[model samples]
Target chain A: MTQARLMDGTALARRIVEETAKRAADITERTGTAPCLATVLVGEDPASVTYVRMKRNRCRTAGITSRHVPLPADTTTEQLVGTLRELSADPGVHGILLQHPMGPHIDERAAFEAIAPEKDVDGVTFASFATMSFGLPGFVSCTPGGIMRLLDEYGVDPAGRRAVVVGRSAILGKPAGMLLLARDATVTYCHSRTTDLSAAVREADIVVAAVGRPRLIRGQDVKPGAVVIDAGYSPGNVGDVDFDSAVKRASLITPVPGGVGPMTIATLLEQTVDAAARQLGV
Target chain B: MTQARLMDGTALARRIVEETAKRAADITERTGTAPCLATVLVGEDPASVTYVRMKRNRCRTAGITSRHVPLPADTTTEQLVGTLRELSADPGVHGILLQHPMGPHIDERAAFEAIAPEKDVDGVTFASFATMSFGLPGFVSCTPGGIMRLLDEYGVDPAGRRAVVVGRSAILGKPAGMLLLARDATVTYCHSRTTDLSAAVREADIVVAAVGRPRLIRGQDVKPGAVVIDAGYSPGNVGDVDFDSAVKRASLITPVPGGVGPMTIATLLEQTVDAAARQLGV
Candidate 1:
């Protein structure tokens, strides 16, 4: 089988990060203030911890200052909200990044809502989601934002195309569909509530598998010459798509480790710099 | 050929208006205040004038008060913004409807932005569009809102379904896709920019045609047993989808005059009442 062209997300992400670093340095040198990103994390899930550390390390490398706020696993919703609200009101903090999957007990949405819309660099707030979905100028969820960049880089124009997104998570599926719809692509969303999966996947010129089910999407189900993006993250780093099967049918496909993952951090850093520039008026 | 079952929008509209009128009267009597809608029109396009007049007349029939603001054709963007801002800040104006098709010279987005997000009853603002797209609690664009209501009334569950929306007008296509996406339907948006419209249409379990083209979608393009909504409008009551051919394939179909048209007015009135309640804190 002829292999599909793999989208080099890592390379693109590196370029984006480098550009962000330069901008950060410029902003710092000109204004005597570095872009500041507040990283909020609740509970120390090993993966979440690693992700937070990686983000901070990346921030330091990009010349952006990082403010770490590690809350206890038993942090009350009020405590988290107060902390976020304080960060939101602080002039020193231009952007706030609240790591996801805080804890089962935490009111995730409520805590997210506490971060001011202007400082919501993580793009998790209702206001940001709405703006992103409407195609209005606003911060976007990192992974979904990265996905669009990949599509654009690959010369996959969404205008008047059929894009089927398999997932319905609030942060992922819904926003992804909204983003594509904004670009004039016909977008469809499937989820646990959906009765049929394969039939839906078969009809797409563009398929975005974000449901986090490992190998839920198979190659045979993909139409010839279609573009496939697997944003799902599994324990072994397996994507939602059956890469072995999908590559044969897909004209362009995103591989898990090399594709979408890298773009998330890139987008985050870029937004941090943007927020800083706007707030500092530099 | 079997005659298509015409979905009667007129009758449906009458019932909805009647229900809205009763609720409006009850709310007014209880609170010593009636629902109030603010209508802002720039320049006197004959069609726009007629539409605003019709909406105002309906508001009166429902016992809702109407506030009308008329601007000359040469009104500058700042002047228009100033006028809209006054209406937005007024506590008595529960809902604001900015009559569309403003003069070419006008900054439409700027004007729409003047209306507070809460009073954007017409759902034209970026905030409203974003909120609608996110499936969050916010006012919806009238036609798309009506379409979803009709779908629910007809028991068309969008979850896990392939929904193709043919058109990408800001108020219609974009918002419709977001609404469908929120309901978990995989929605694809197709428009003039689309390369292959037929293939996209054929895959839809639910199709919404909002392009103002008359009879553009043929019956052969529709999937059998799909729910079809024709939201297109022309001078002489023409629809976007070719009704005659589409009916043969669609399990349920909304007729042009009797389907989506009535729902727009209904949704408008419903939102006006809702706005009144919220503003009045009742």
Candidate 2:
């Protein structure tokens, strides 16, 4: 059996970052203001810390500056909102990214809303989500935004395709489906409430597995020659799709770690520069 | 052949309006201030004029006051936005409704965003759209809100059902699908670009025909025992669904003229009263 071609997100992300660096340099040279991203993390969650650190490293690579704001785990929602508001007001901070899964007591939506719409490069704000849903020009949720870029890089036209998104989380599955729908794809959102997930998967020309369930989608469920994008990252680096079985059936597939993960930070850095250019009026 | 039961949106709308009337009266009696809905018309489009007249009549019946602001066909976007902003700030105005398709030159989104989120009874603002998409607490687009009410009245639980939403207009189709998805229905959005609309519709337990093409969904496309909601309105009182044929196949269906039409205005009035109550602290 002919194996499916892998969609190399790592290589594509590198190209994107390279292009973004050029734009960042141009902006800084013209305006003498380096694009900066402010990442606010509440509590000392080890995973979040690591994620923030990785993003900061990518910022450095792309000629963007990073500012870290660490709040105590017991910080009040008002305090978090205040810090986000300050970052939003700072002309130096072109993009504001509030790391997710903050303390349970913190009002996540309130914190997200505190970030000015122009500075919400992470695309967690309601304003950004609205723009994405309406297909208007605005920053997109980084992972979903990266997914679109990857599709574009692979020369995949979403128009008229039957795309089934196997998740409905606000940031990932919902926005991803919205982006596909905006591109004129016939999109289906299947979640835990879906009675027959396999049946839906079989009918898809493009399958996006975004639910964090390791190997939830089996090979038999995949349509032959389908484009499979496994956006779900579970423990042990396992994806939502069973890679070994899916590779034989899919025409194109994204590997777990090197697929959506790299594209996300690349999108953030790219959008950070874009936001800076817009703010600096360059 | 067993004919499908009609969803009877007219009767439901009447009930909804009656309930809204009581709420309006109670709020007025307690606060000594009647709920007021300000309708802004950009141009004297006949359809829009008629719609505004009808809405005002309903407001009168519900004991809610109506304020009309008419602009010429050559009105600038800034002028329209200014009017909306003034109404949004007015303590007397509880809800704002802007009649759409405004001259094709007006920045409709700018005008919609001018209405305060608290007074956006028509639910056209981006903030309202985001709240609806995320299943958060806020006003919903009137027609989509009415569709949910109809579903509840008929004991149709959207959870776990296969729902196909045809059309993806900002107010109607998109919000309808999002609302269904929020209710745990596996939702598919099929538009003009869909490769096989019939096939997608045939898999749905609940089908919403919102595309304004007359009789686009035939009887054969509808799943047997499916609950069909026809939110489309075309010339000659036609709907997107072929009612004569679809009624024979579906378990429940809505008529073109009497089904979704009344519900739209009813939702607007109901939300107006709700907005007034919230604003007045009554």
Candidate 3:
């Protein structure tokens, strides 16, 4: 049995970070101000804390300034909105990332909308979603943007291809399917409520597993010669796809930790520089 | 062979218009001014002119006022945008409809954006699309809103259903698929570049034909007991689906002239009253 080639998101992310760092330095030199990203965390959930730290570290490594706003767990929707709007209006902040999974009481959409469209480098606003769905020029959700960069890096043309996105989340599966569709792929979105999950996956020329259910996609369900992307990150470092089995049947695959994960932060850093350039008129 | 039951869009549309007229009357009684819809037609295209006239007549029949703005064929994008913005700002104009298929010179998206989101009763704005896709409460594209009403009227639950939308037009097939997806249908979008259109159609439990191609979906491609909706209207009054053949196998189908066409205008009138209600705070 032929094993699939692994799509190395780690190496590509590094390359992107290097390029982004150079752009950031150039902007700092000419504009007399460094590109800055303001990250807002509603509460200190352990995983959320770790994720924010990683992003902030990446920002520092990429020559961008990171501003952290740690809100109390009891913060109300109005308070969160005010804080986000403040960051949005801050001229020194080039980009804004509001780390989500904020408490149940939080109106996530309202908080996301508070981030100005221009400084919304994390790409979570309705304006960004509209642009992404319509294939218009605008900032895209980081994970989906990273996924597209991976597809381009591997020379995978989505035109006339059958791509099944096995999730319907706002940032991941939805935008991933949209980006693929924008490239002329026949995109199918399968969710938890899908009647025949295996049947849908079996028909895919490319499969994107983004539902956060570990091992939801089995190796036997994968079509031979298909490109398999596991954007799902479940507990215990597991992905949505059963990697061992899928590798035997697929042409290309992304391992969770080393694949889609790194690309997300990379894309955020790259877009931060882009947003800075636009705002700086450089 | 069990012939499919026809979904009577004309009858349903009449019912909707009657209800809309009552709402329009209520608004007119409470407020001194009747709700007004501004129909902007840019060019002398026969189809565009016919569509505008239909909308205007529907407005008058529903006891709403109609304002016409006919621009020249050579109207520039900036000029059309300015005119739309003026209508948007007009307190008397509750809804704005820019009859599309405007000549090649006009930038359609730019013109659509000029209409304020609150007054975008036609639901062509990016704001409307984002809300529609996100399943948020907002005015939907008229054709899509009409289709959803039909689905609800017929008690067709989209949950766990396989829906194939055989087009990707921004306002029609795209919004249709998103609407179905919001209802928990596993939606697959097939378009001109789709490699296996027949295979895709055969797998659908619900098929929405909105590609603007006459008789593109054939009987052999439809699964027995499928629900077929023909939203496409080409010249010669033919629909996208081969209705005669598809009806022999499908459980439900929409015909060309009497189906999907009348619903479009009905939806527009209904939404116009809705916009007026919101504006009048009644």
Candidate 4:
């Protein structure tokens, strides 16, 4: 069988960031104030630091200002929440991002709730999730939003399709299913609790592998002509899906490093400018 | 073929209401304040009036007081929002219920957002929707909450199950899917935009019919031994699933008038009491 056409998220993301830069420039000129994103990170986890720095670097290229708040590993939930609350009330901050997995004791959800919906550019708030679930106009969680954009870019219409989302993390799998559901796709969620994962994957017209296990989805299990999205990434740039095996079965597939990872930062920048425009009334 | 066991929602609701009434009475006696629910009705539609009256009547029977706010058919969105804002600020009103289907001119979502999350017992606010999506501690939309309770009452464990939800309305299908996802069930949302509804239904281990269509699901499309929940309702008390056909193929099913309907009211009363207890600190 012929190999599936690759969904080039990296190329799409680059184009998106370029467009966002122009919009940011226009907004700054019109309002005399540039878009600003405040990122708070607790502890110096290497991965977290790298992700935050990457985002800030992208913001600089996009003509947006970035504020970084690094807290100690022993920071309490109250301190974190207070810091986020201040950011929420700050008129200069158009967007806020609190890096995930903040130590074991700190209440992560509480910190997310502290960010005002208007400034929730990362779309991690309860309001944004609900709006996405209802298919109303609102900022979506970055990865899921980027995935939807990628699908639209590739002309993969979700309307009436059987789309199976493998995994159910709050920011990824769950919201992804809701977004698909809103677009009129029949969405199924599979996770660790799923009894027959392979059987469920075989029936999908569109398969989203986001369980974070490298090569979890093999080629033989994928339906012929299905759209396979490997949203999972392990250390060393390995994706959840078996790329070699899946490519033979799928009609379309996303490759590691060049797939969902890059799209996330692209969506974050796009939404930041959108938020800034709204806040500035430009 | 053996007939499915009919799940009795009326009996379950009566039991639930009794417990709610007792808790409400105790709280009122201790705090010297009765539980109060603010019912905001827009326009003079007969069905809206009837539903509001039914809720108020039930509140009275459960020892909860009702505060009514009736608006004109020509009421503008700002005026409606202002009224809701005033009610939201009132300390006496422990819970707020905005009857659905406000006039087309009014922005219903804006009005719903006006009600503070603390008083949004009906779970229409954006915050409540997000909390439900995240599986956080917050109230849920009544019909969806009731349907979940019915499933639990019938011993239908969602974990490791494949749940296919038919419909995508904000208050019903969408939230129902989220609740199921929270419990680790594989969920699929099907709606009018879906191409092959029968095939989707046949793959479900559990089916939630919330499209309000009469007899939309037939037995031929049902998987044997699946748990079927019919949340649909028509003018003549008709359910979405064809009872005669579905009963023969399912392991359990909920009846129309006595099923999801009663649970909605039960959940309403329960949330009202919980709100009152929190506000009064009893």
Best prediction by DockQ: 2
* Residue B271 shift from truth in candidate 3, angstroms: 1.1
The local distance difference test score of model 3 is 0.93
Instruction: Looking at model 3 chain B, report the run of 10 residues with the lowest lDDT sum.
Output: B42-51
**Winning candidate number (TM-score):** 2
Better of 1 and 3 by DockQ: 3
| TM values, all candidates | 0.91, 0.99, 0.97, 0.98
- DockQ of structure 1: 0.44
Q: List the residue pairs that clash in candidate 3.
A: none
Rank order (by DockQ, best first): 2, 3, 4, 1
For model 3 the interface RMSD, in Å, equals: 0.7
For model 1, how does the per-residue alpha-carbon lDDT over A1-282 read when each residue is reduced to its tens digit? 788999999999999999999999999999999999999999889999999999999999999999999999999999999999999999999999999888888988789989998998888887787677657788988889999999999999987777888886767877787788778776767777666778878878899999889999999889999999999989898999999889999999999889999999999999999999999998
Residue B38 error for model 2, in Å? 0.6
Task: Give fnat for candidates 1, 2 and onward, in order.
Answer: 0.64, 0.98, 0.88, 0.97
Give the distance in Å from residue B59's predicted Cα in candidate 4 to where it truly belongs: 1.0
- lDDT score of model 2? 0.94
Clashing residue pairs in candidate 4 are: A187-B188
Q: Candidate 2 on A53-162: residue-level lDDT in tens?
A: 99999899889999999988999999999999899999889999999988779989999999999999999888899899989999999999999998898988999999
| Per-chain TM-score (chain B), model 3 | 0.98
Among these predictions, the greatest lDDT belongs to: 2
Considering only chain B, report the TM-score of model 2: 0.99
**Docking level for model 4:** high
Tens-digit lDDT track of model 3 for B120-188: 898999889888888998889999889888888887999999999999888998899999999999999
Q: Which stretches of candidate 3 lie over 4 Å from their true place?
A: none
Proportion of true inter-chain contacts also present in candidate 3: 0.88
